[model samples]
Target: MSSPLSVILTQNKLTGENFNDWKRNLLIVLNFEKHSFVLAQPRPPTPAIDAPDRDFVALERWDNSNLSAMCYIRASMSNVLQKQHEEHQT
Candidate 1:
């Protein structure tokens, strides 16, 4: 079965023209999922080889959240918008 998030996104695909509304909806879902930190905080730089364990952990969490959030954003975007953003680094 499709996920609730997929259902919401299917109902309100991001078409660029409704960017503000789409962003609001997306933020609400991300926050509810506890993945909003990836967007709220600046990404921590790659931890050094000698970095503390906590640093490594933070980076891992940030990386996971970034990837997950990006996937959700891309999934919700209109096909044209998704293609246009396919090469974006961030």
Candidate 2:
């Protein structure tokens, strides 16, 4: 269920002792995927029906980035960690 690009990011999965390296690698991959923005920004609130177009667009972008980051994070974790974090978004 993971993307092929996960291979590039998960060369060394997030073992407990490797937080620094794992985070660095994950950020590099996330940046390459153009999803690093989600790390710096909080999730935007959902737009109202009559909200400006830009609001919808921002929410869409946030969703894409959040999903991508979540998948990558899961793909790079040990099975135990992944299960514990199944529903985490940030």
lDDT of each: 0.82, 0.84
lDDT of 2 by residue, 6-88 (tens): 67666879877888989988887888788989989998999899999999999999998888888888888888888888887
Top TM-score hit: 1
Model 2: clashing residue pairs? Answer: none
> After best superposition, candidate 2 residue 61: deviation in angstroms?
0.8
C-alpha lDDT of residue 17 in model 2: 86
Candidate 1 lDDT by residue in tens digits, 1-90: 134665676677899899888888888778776788988798999988998999999988988888878888888999999999999766
Candidate 2 has an lDDT of: 0.84
Candidate 2 lDDT for residue 12: 70
Off by over 4 Å in 2: 1-5
